[model samples]
Target chain A: MQHKPIHIIIVDDHPMVIEGLKTLLSDDKRVLIKNQFMNGTDTLTYLEHNSADIVLLDVNLPDINGVEMVPKILNIRANIGVIGLSTYSEPSIINQMIKKGVKGYLLKNVTGEELVNAITQVHQGDFYFGSEVQKILADSVTQESNDQPKLTRREKHILTLIAEGKTTNNIAEELFISPLTVETHRRNLMQKLEVPNAASLIKVAVEKHLI
Target chain B: MQHKPIHIIIVDDHPMVIEGLKTLLSDDKRVLIKNQFMNGTDTLTYLEHNSADIVLLDVNLPDINGVEMVPKILNIRANIGVIGLSTYSEPSIINQMIKKGVKGYLLKNVTGEELVNAITQVHQGDFYFGSEVQKILADSVTQESNDQPKLTRREKHILTLIAEGKTTNNIAEELFISPLTVETHRRNLMQKLEVPNAASLIKVAVEKHLI
Candidate 1:
């Protein structure tokens, strides 16, 4: 018995990219190109009547960008899986697409087999992350946000207490550290940041993603 | 006729936050608290059988950070709506969560009425963003990625042509610039970047996000 083919819509501005994808995906029996669009507006227009199992969306569309289009597509149909295809590796774009409910994240230069696998996995209700995509996700998770003090575990605990409006002496006594050490941390932070005061240093720490 | 109440889950380590959310949401007849988890791992466990229509997710989860857990929750159920609730306003984290398929992005200081509105909007398949969240999204779109060169539109067009192996004479002709001006730009770039050669300059420029 044969299974139903995976219907897909390709949305991109470049004719060469669409042509290339058609050529690459033509040989797969499980896949069928339902429609192709040159821009986000066209894709949305097509979605008014037609819905595909998966969508190959380019983030840098000429009209509406891929990140902006994710929500619009989901609004049309929540289950229509999107696989983002882009050349740039910016974390912001990647994160935006992911939050917009994209099931597969891949670079434009993805191997044919990987592309096929990603579509299949997403179709089967599993996420597909290319190696670089995974690295970007991990980096986002591990990297400290720009605001907040870059604190070690102990330092973080100290910061929490500080943010809670605790005094250095009280914090030091509570955390079993010397008041001199607390003063030392304060001094070190000021020196490293070249700030004049603790309040200003905290502001800097919050602004720089140092936390 | 009445609709089924929205099932909700609250994930945060802070007892105060849980109590506050409960207090805020309890009076609303449309919302029903399904479960509350202290961390990402517990939230993951609860999702095994119990499904929630909305989840109030905190970025600073005790076991796994919310940025990491956003994917995990989406992986569990692509349709479940997640609203990020955190004290942190770091663009990176907010952007990361948005990419991970959150339906609403709100700060921890959100009022009860606002939270209810967000949850209702998300449940009805609409995106929601607080004023600050909207500002963050707008700022993120404008904020240049550190990896890419921050070139003016003309410079980027020129650089793109150069990256495509265009000669200075060819680029000058295409961009309608004098050869002397091209040389001037080349020299200025070298001086500002402290690169020895054009090839090195292009490489460094691309690397530094300076187009």
Candidate 2:
């Protein structure tokens, strides 16, 4: 059956990565390289005037975070598929990206065939994941089903600020809350995460993707 | 003239990355893939029994940090070349890897040619850096020559604790110092980093690689 070539856009900050992807996927006859961008801003700008069937988006970009960019990209083109690509297999990041509605997740080391398959799958409205990504997803699912702590929106906000090294006073000033309230939230976060100290609290929060 | 092929080991947690690297470098006649491992412990264990000319070490690993693993790997084989490979171009990580005696640093997106060239250069006892890594190094140097804060060891420890969201009391308890002493050090760190709040202090310190 004859079909239109799937248009794909590559967005990553590293020139070498972009070049490598181009070289790796050039031989695939079923896909057309629509464009390449180095940052989220440029990707968004290109998407405003153009359309693609799939986007291979790096999880970390020089401008905007790839996960944060997913929903924004979707808002611009509701049907375009987004694939999260990164070197990290952190369950937290992978889970977050999936939650943000990426159609697939791939590691940077995916084979040319795997890349093609991922794009093809996503183009056909199926989700794909690299082997390691799949493992992370499976593990995260198991963990979430077990004892994942549910955090309030305010607590999540405070936790992120804390991860950024905000003091209680600074968080209070920024959130327009009392320092005591921030401290209470901090303690509540620690208790909920079951961490003994601030360092362990931050570490656990990061591991659990609470922040 | 035919020369002996360089033996190389790949250490990264991602099975696909290892597979991809094996596939990418398989055709290079001048280099031989001696071994591949998924974590630092296995890499170290392999090094304990065997040796390689170069180790393409990922900065982030599942078991131990790649940077921390560098000296341990070198300890096993002092003459072996260590090349830091990662998705990050963060100056702090790059600078730390280089300082720890890695002969090269390459981003995960490096072209096959660049990867081979980096291995060859490192094998020949020369330092090589990906273009983006070079730019980060250059910018960090410029920034350091300007107003980069000089922090003492104790202060650096305190800064790390603070970034972990530790309060003065928490830090004092952990470090066995008085709360007033911890507060003084915290104030000094903020002053030295020229940040108005703890958040900005950590942000600047991280940007400057002070911690």
| lDDT agreement with native, every candidate | 0.74, 0.83
Q: What is the lDDT of residue B163 in candidate 2?
A: 68
* Lowest lDDT 10-residue stretch of candidate 1 chain A: A202-211
Best model number under DockQ: 2
Report the lDDT tens digits of candidate 1 across residue range B73-156: 989888899999876466666766777788898876577788899999999999999887898777867874322323456665
DockQ of each candidate's interface versus the true one? 0.01, 0.16
Question: Mind giving the per-residue lDDT tens digits that candidate 1 earns over A73-134?
Answer: 99998889899998546665687678778998987656667878999999999999889788
Question: What's the CA error at residue A38 for candidate 2, in Å?
Answer: 7.1
Task: Give the lDDT of residue B97 in candidate 1.
Answer: 77
